[model samples]
Target chain A: MADEAGAAKERKILVAVDESEESMYALTWCLKNVSVSSNSKDTLILLYVMPPRTVYTALDGTGYLFSSDIMATMQKYSNDVADCVIEKSKRMCREQVQDVKVETIIEHGDPRDAICQVAEKLHVDMLVMGSHGYGLIKRAFLGSVSNHCAQNVKCPVLIVKRPKASSGSS
Target chain B: MADEAGAAKERKILVAVDESEESMYALTWCLKNVSVSSNSKDTLILLYVMPPRTVYTALDGTGYLFSSDIMATMQKYSNDVADCVIEKSKRMCREQVQDVKVETIIEHGDPRDAICQVAEKLHVDMLVMGSHGYGLIKRAFLGSVSNHCAQNVKCPVLIVKRPKASSGSS
Candidate 1:
């Protein structure tokens, strides 16, 4: 077919995942709805971005309430969350598309910037993410990460918003 | 093998096209980067939205600048542009993906609202569009059509941004 020549090149699709159900829904949606070519070498890279750890100073805004061990425990919990999210997302891909090549990536920073940076560094063909679906007031106070990456990422960005009716089912 | 069951249902992808080079580039990018499945019956709907015809009323904002003949001429020009854009886009799909089914839709209204409404009405699986890549000032001054659709559309929205480096090559 005419498209065979175009399918020779490998295409990488980066999907940003975290603890949110929205992100997982995005991964499922992509598996069901977006893949460049079945004959082509297509890879689904599951990306998990961890928020940067906050330092505890003597006069920190939180009153330096946490001791050294407490801070370490918090860091451990964050790592656990990231691991769980990645494992779940990988399992989903395996269940949905058996032959799809899958890879995992973990980054640290603000999600908005880290997502864009990793997508550029990896030179992905497209970036898939889920919108938190925040309302007007909540979105205003806590800016939407998907929106930020959509504006900044150099590659194509796919923002998947779970339908309101299906939100409860998921 | 596992995906065959999922591929039985038909998937519709809506790609919004216009006169802008960015939009054309987006169509090309989508053809190369995003398609649900090769075996599944997927339809690509090339939608060209005409900005709603302006009302030329006496004592209007333009100080009653247009006569009846002028208004009719302007309307004809708008229709011509829509036809030309759709033809160009159809040719592109034929060149790239010959076997894939393609459809065309011409809508009249503000693109932001019209795009969202059309995607919902068609029950498309995904909505593909090109990012105008407006700067902060320009985007603020004239709200982005892609951004609005991404926020409002029920289906996954793919906003393809033509890379700055390759913008000139195309």
Candidate 2:
């Protein structure tokens, strides 16, 4: 336990990003706050976990599948979106805290499993995520992402919440 | 936004605690990290939001009334739990970081709304909480508490995830 706590002193922060505004807000908050001063030397990893793509099977459930061409097209689209989000996060890091080293990882799997697996594999000191996500229905799923990640991960998780429509909280 | 960011420089962290082990772990984690260094000077407010206890009401569509004695007993029980949790958290602060100013607030209402309301009212720099309160059934509710607090609160929220049964995570 002491060793685990000691390792935490040197921050290896992981920020889970998607195309959610909440996630972007969390990344910004982390840069301006959690990763500061001495923490600037720490690596802030931007992780984007894309759910494993599943090609649609035949309506008859007879093992017929989508054409390889269609499957490839969808896969390419997912990768493109991942790249865009990562690039935008990198820019935010650059603009917010120039010293903190930033890295990116794009994984394919259940986001809950992928995130916890990556964070554990990296032995990150902390897992930072945003509260909600793109839509109301998606927000509930994102909530599960954070909830599962929090329960499964070893390190402390910082879930930055995005203010509601009012923006009168502060 | 700049003014909000400026105000955040002085860390006013709030940790929401209950009788759950997960919450205790989170409070301990916050003491060891978030409230460290210059943050010691920053105030650490330990908040315990007790859900309003519903006293037994007479079963009728009319003016139902629970006996005052029964109501008083239940309220006292609720208050006792709140006090016990708060006292335990205060002890953690004393043992962990004596320099960090520790304060406590006990509020009776819906845990979700009460937490967000208190955080907004206090304009805390950050809100730290535990994930997965009791079990799977309770988790859905606690998830909403963290989710609601994160979405509704003004400050960045940290939901500390407790290690799972396997504990193979680094």
Candidate 3:
């Protein structure tokens, strides 16, 4: 119980990734910034949400038709995406921060919902993500994943923008 | 110039939106929480960043072919996303607060980058977002966007978590 209590105080950092360049940049930044000391355990959690798949079976005016294999295929695809993100994260962690423990999670649901659920479950110290502006119409049409996460999570959220390589260029 | 200057100082609240349920919740929270006085100008800037098109373009042998059309399309999309976010923001502002001016901005770039840039340009007092935890593997893979922003940006960031719908759920 003492050991467990000690572990609870550890600083947990949660990161959201979509395999985008900005996401990659965010991952790299976390490794460099978070430090683990004897007193404080620093853990990093990487999360990827699989786009939810809903099936619509056709009815021949009488009853239900046949179910498709798309759901299975999508689950496999989601697992594959998680695997890829994990592999990359591991490699980067190994190269950047040697002492920190890294964890990976993959879920299927609304990206915002999944993220909030995970963050609460873990009770992390902070949540971090990368953002790119989405225009009004597209945002209305599609939705902003980061915005949802920011609004729902209780911890402090750090949003990293791609660093200007040069101030002169937009 | 006087009107523009007055507008700038009116305690602007910039809420980043991506049209997600969590973001909308944050928008609602912001509307309910932030106060506006007659002497103060409360402006809510709904910012959206369109993911860069170059990310999708095939690298091919040429290596990152930049197209003018794609840039234009991205800008248009960014504007649309901002517009959608602004509409919701305004509605909330109207319902929740008084004597407030709401504005929206859309940019084509990384979301994190766009947000920080706007915050600085507008000299906003604070930034509000949501936190979603990525699982262990992904956390290791992607790092944390909020952490990165906290380290880099000058303003204070507020990360909101979803409230438990019921006490039993907690």
Top-scoring candidate (DockQ): 1
TM-score of 3: 0.44
| Candidate 3 lDDT by residue in tens digits, B91-116 | 77686666677777767666667777
- Model 1 lDDT tens row, A1-170: 22321442687889999887778778887887675336347799999987566433332457567876777787889899889999999999888787889999988766777888989999888899988832345457659988888888988899987666744553
lDDT of each prediction vs. the true structure?
0.77, 0.75, 0.59
Q: What TM-score would you give candidate 1 relative to the actual structure? A: 0.85
* lDDT tens digits by residue: candidate 2, B1-170: 33344344567898999888778888877776667655546788999877565423432223455456767777788789989999999998888787888889998767888888888899788989876543455556565576567556767778776666335543
- Choose 1 or 3, whichever is better by lDDT: 1
Candidate 2 residues A24-57, lDDT tens each? 8888878766786555568999999875664233
Q: Which 10-residue span in candidate 3 chain A carries the lowest summed lDDT?
A: A1-10
- Which 10-residue span in candidate 3 chain B carries the lowest summed lDDT? B1-10
Model 2, global lDDT: 0.75
Chain B TM-scores across candidates? 0.82, 0.81, 0.67
Off by over 4 Å in 1: A1-8, A55-63, A133-142, B1-8, B55-63, B133-142, B168-170
Q: Write the per-residue lDDT of candidate 3 for residues A20-82, one digit (tens) a residue.
A: 666666566555433322213578888877666542222222344533465456567767877
How much is the lDDT of residue B59 in candidate 1?
23
Question: Which ranking of candidates, highest lDDT first?
Answer: 1, 2, 3
